[model samples]
Target: MAARVWRDPVLWLAFGFGSGLAPVAPGTFGTLPGVVLAALLGLLAPAIGVPLWAVVLLALIVLTPIGIGLCGAASRRLGVHDHGGIVFDEIVGVLIPFLLVPVTPWTLLLAFLWFRLFDVVKPWPIRWLDRHVSGGWGIMVDDLLAGVFALAAVGLSVHFWPG
Candidate 1:
């Protein structure tokens, strides 16, 4: 079973390139890829002269749909809904805060912490959506909302603290 999961391309991606396969805290491990992706996108600002926020926006636009498809398909294949092994949503979720904030180490750390908090807590609408929605969109939307919560929290923190 594990070998088949590793060999399948869709599962490979939906599982966050094996990060989601971790014995514990798979979401946290899976989010590492998003951090790497966000950092690379940050670099595009100097390389192509594009703004970091714009690049992040474009990345979110592109990745969200792809994540949805991959997540939903993986769920069907596994005969499970939003399995622990499916962390593509987490990978995409962690990218949201970077949309408007500077991609500094401090910001990354804050984003990770805040995103994880919101994801784990699932306050109000996030929890509601997580329970009500189903399939790929269901799995992805809750985390996306958590990302928004993290984004707002991080944005405010950066604004007031300005470190």
Candidate 2:
């Protein structure tokens, strides 16, 4: 399958640097790199005395445009247009919760499951975006919406039990 997606770096990135290559639950596995990134950023942010939330938000701001580019180009190259292998969008979604919620093991698990739920279920507007949006926006917007939902739910938990 390398021939299918090996030609382009953007495709490689959009595939989560090969995390999306898993045969089962590609989307779920594809999110691993993002989780790893969130964990690392959580560790590093405190070293610099920066708030974890601030670091996550900054990553979203910086990486999103790049994700858009990668997702769009990769979709075109794969010609599947939001193929299961194109999971950089899920990473972006997972990152959203990391913006406000600290990346603990429990929180990471919650973020992962919750983001996957929203992404798979695609409730209301999330589904709407998935159906209506096209290209990179199409690929990334729904997952970003999932991230927002996850952020809200996890944010509430963080507030209630901010240990």
Candidate 3:
């Protein structure tokens, strides 16, 4: 059966433009929309008045909850918990590493790699949250931590990378 997102526009956004519908590696694909969004915001920041960092920060703050709600609702409708195809959480998580960071291809690629690593590994408190938290929060929290981990890694890279 096709995903509800195919029939519903709202679900389409929540599911990260059907990236989450991929049979393999949905999480990775799902994160792509956030990457594109960050890149566009960064590219447009100069023309748009707001700084790239501000745009990234605002997006994470505003959209995180909405992603949570959407993921939770989708999970409920599907009768499953944290389904792979419900990856709005991945999109939200990917945004964190780019907050206040340059959105160049190099930086974005590094951040994406780190986000995926931390997301898949689920280290320490991230793993704890994954185990204890439930519902949409459950789906979102670990990825949020992964983004933070990636943020730190990306920060270090930015600092150390020489001209």
- What TM-score fits each model? 0.96, 0.92, 0.92
Off by over 4 Å in 3: none
What's the candidate order when arranged by decreasing lDDT? Answer: 1, 2, 3
Model 1 regions lying over 4 Å from their true place = none
Clashing pairs in 1: none
Could you tell me which 10 consecutive residues in candidate 3 have the lowest summed lDDT? 1-10
Q: Rate the local accuracy (lDDT) of all candidates.
A: 0.91, 0.86, 0.82
Name the Cα RMSD for model 3: 1.6
Model 1 lDDT at residue 25: 93
Q: Pick the candidate with the highest TM-score.
A: 1
Query: Residues 1-163, candidate 2, lDDT per residue (tens digit)?
Result: 6555566677788888887888899999998888888899989899999999898889899888888888989888777889998889888789899777788997888888888888889999999999999998889889999999988878887778664
In candidate 1, how many Å is residue 36 off?
1.1
Model 3 over residues 49-142: C-alpha lDDT tens digits?
8887788888888988887888778777778888888778888888887775878898888888888988888899998998899898888888
- Candidate 2: global Cα-lDDT? 0.86
List of clashing residue pairs for candidate 3 = none
